[model samples]
Target: MNARAEAFTRCGSAITTNALTKTFHGHTVLQPTHLEIASGEILVLLGPSGCGKTTLLRLIAGLEQPDGPNMIRFDGEDVSALPIEKRNVGMVFQSYALFPNMTVAENVGYGLKVKGIRRKQRESETKRLLALVGLEDYADRRITTVSGGQRQRTALARALAIKPRVLLLDEPLAALDAVLRERLRVEIGLLLREFGITAVYVTHDQAEAMAIGDRIAVMQRGRIEQIGAPKAIYHRPANDFVADFVGTMNRLEGRVSDGILAVDAEHTQARLRVGGGDRSAVVCFRPEVARLTAGPGAIRARVIATTFFGATQRLVAEVAPGRQLQLDLASSLHFAPGQIVAFDADPQAIIEFEKDA
Candidate 1:
């Protein structure tokens, strides 16, 4: 590896934020928060609009000042007062942000050139980075001449050329089509890990978060609702919001009796076996937990619709008069609307939350 390329693979920065916050006028957009990002780890901030994910990312980048002082540190060094450039943080936005007038190599090496690196060294480094991003053959191609995925790679190459201590990406794949975005996200995840840079990604897409993040922080309102690994967050959500946001959860709201929840207690239909003792409770489980069964005692539902998902099929079934549940079955069988079906849920798959949550 070239000296320049080798430098990027060195240990990335470890980040810490203490009581970090941001407020505008009289409203606080980001409440007091604390975060720890391990060296070379990728942490994703996942949430919907106005969830403060972007606000938190910007604060870490030094693009926006934190509401409090001594709140951010890089490898234990206070860097809250540093500006974006001085902080040595690389940023990739949704837009490619490549220089349309310049060739791909020129755009990737622009940062090194601005740092006063000599032409010979800059060209060598640019060549390496272009090849690193698999665009070696398109060094002289203009940004407008390449594919969207290539342009995205160019933007990333440009960011990494400076060997920044950290990388911040905000919805970098938001501009691409669904199919292309899906394909590129895997490529991007591999690229980021190859560089071993501490990265903070902000995105509202759950699938994107699951694919890219080593740990995902699900933000809500002005604070982080939960942070954990992708499977941990999905299978064991911290609360109702996290459960509902991370994926499709089938929730049954009714009274539990004798470790069972029956939507229609008298008919014994639509049961989600649970352990609430005996009280009004909401039983939550993933769509994959329920499976088709044949028995008079099994939970019964009337299929409202079915959506085929290639390897699996999702059924929207009406459990009660106004209650519906989504079940995913690994079956090629077909069921028409209004067809009565019996199913059973794994009791271990049940996720319970406090009523207030």
Candidate 2:
């Protein structure tokens, strides 16, 4: 086996968190959380800033202490008291933490050097890691001379040098530009799959979470609101918060009557099939599910803006006096400002939540 594959064989471990809680000073930042991650699974902790995703990651990495002991485990071994350096966990951060004075190879081998590994073995491992990351030719280049993406790859390689049992990444792509971030997201996902190591990735970007995570844990306030695969989280949200947070959700305010819900817009009315006993309801659907049609019972709207996105075109139309609805259509379809259009959402695509929900 190659050095990288050999290293990975000794690495991947399942992780479990039991009642993991974190409190700062006098305030509790993370509520008691229990999670189990299978070996070689990529679980993403997704939430906004200050929502405790980072706190949970730090706790797993041993950078932050939990409220009590027996709270964290790796492959059934309790490691609550272990420190960050002793946890044997790899970490990659948003800031490329590369030493400016070191070359790419030097940076990749720093962890092994600190462990007092033999110079020859360290060089061999570093060479293997560089090749795995597709930076074999740039090993001797100075850290300052490499591009942002290269620096990220170096950081990843360094983290893997120790053959860590678990990997913790905290917003690792937030600092990169949009294009670079997209490109590196795919690369990182592939690398994680190839290594088959348990990883806990933290990110506030929903798209990034969907792209890389095998399963996602969506956090809110101090607790996880939902945990599921990308498709489940996107299509079958646990609550309104989850539905609104994962993607663009279009809402129609209406009242249910006679087995049908009628949405009264400024100029037209939209009907939806919903179950409720003549009560107020808010129907929600994604932008991609809303379609423009000329049939009756469609909501009348005036196109206000259109944006071309190569594969698809997005249209923002005023459905009410001050409210707008957004929909994505085929790029070949033409839409112009001030043009009146009628649109309807499929019954199967509409999700009905209580007006106050």
Candidate 3:
């Protein structure tokens, strides 16, 4: 790594927000959010587009000022009062936002230029950053002439040029195609780790969050529903809302009696650890957990539809009229539609949540 990059790594900054809140037009967009991000760790704020994920990211970047009793701290010092440029934070936007008139190198060196750095120093630093992002030879190329991926790389170079203590990414891959998004996601993860700069990534894509985050914070209504490793968040969600939001889930909603849940009038009852709430409960199981096998506690489901997805088959089965359960099976098995198969899930695979619990 270049000396400029090395300097950013050595800072080893930390970010914390105490009751961070954002409101617009008398409506609270983000509720008070209390979060702590460790030094050099990659924290991803994930949710749908309108769920305040971007608002939270902007608040941290100082792009959106916070509202009362709220604070943003970096390296144990309050930074809420600082302007965006004064925060010394690297931010890569979803829109690459490269100046059309400037060459790749000029855009990369723009931040340094604005800081009044010497011309030779800016040139050397820009070269190092371009090489870092694998765009060294394209330095003189016009921004309009490069591919979307290259333009995104140029945006990264510009952000890093400032030697920011903390890096902020705002849906940086939303513009790329599927292949480029996948490829750059991995590459960005590598670069963040290599540079050892603390990064806060905002995105609604669960796969991206799972792929790049050291720890993920699932945001909803401007509040964090859960925060943990990707696998933990997937396998064990904090609530029904999170389970449904994070991945594909087969939800069976019904009433529970004596720690057992009845899927329907067909008398299929499964062991459930129901606590608190006399109304109804939602039993969630991943499609992959449901097996087409005849055994004790197996419920018969008629396969109504099937779709092939390369390595797996998605089988949609009906437990009752308009009540369906999805099963994920290996591609090796080609079950025909209208076939009745005994569908059962391992006890450990089932997660039950009460409607009012």
- Candidate closest to the true structure, highest TM-score: 1
Model 1, backbone clash pairs (residues 3+ apart or across chains), number: 0
Q: What is the per-residue lDDT of model 3 for residues 39-59, given as tens digits with 9 covering 90 to 100?
A: 999999999768899999998
- The residue-by-residue lDDT of candidate 1 on 72-133, one tens digit each, is 99999999999997999888988978888999999999999999999999999999988888
Mind giving the per-residue lDDT tens digits that candidate 2 earns over 122-171? 99989999999999999999999999999999998999889899999999
- Model 2: lDDT equals 0.89
Error of 1 at 352 (Å): 0.8
Instruction: Name the runs in model 1 displaced over 4 angstroms.
Output: 1-6, 265-268, 295-297
Deviation from truth (RMSD, Å), model 3: 2.7
lDDT of each: 0.89, 0.89, 0.85
Question: Local error of candidate 1 at 162, Å?
Answer: 0.4
TM-score on alpha carbons, each prediction:
0.95, 0.94, 0.92
The TM-score, computed over Cα atoms with residue i paired to residue i, of candidate 1 is 0.95
Clashes of each: 0, 0, 0
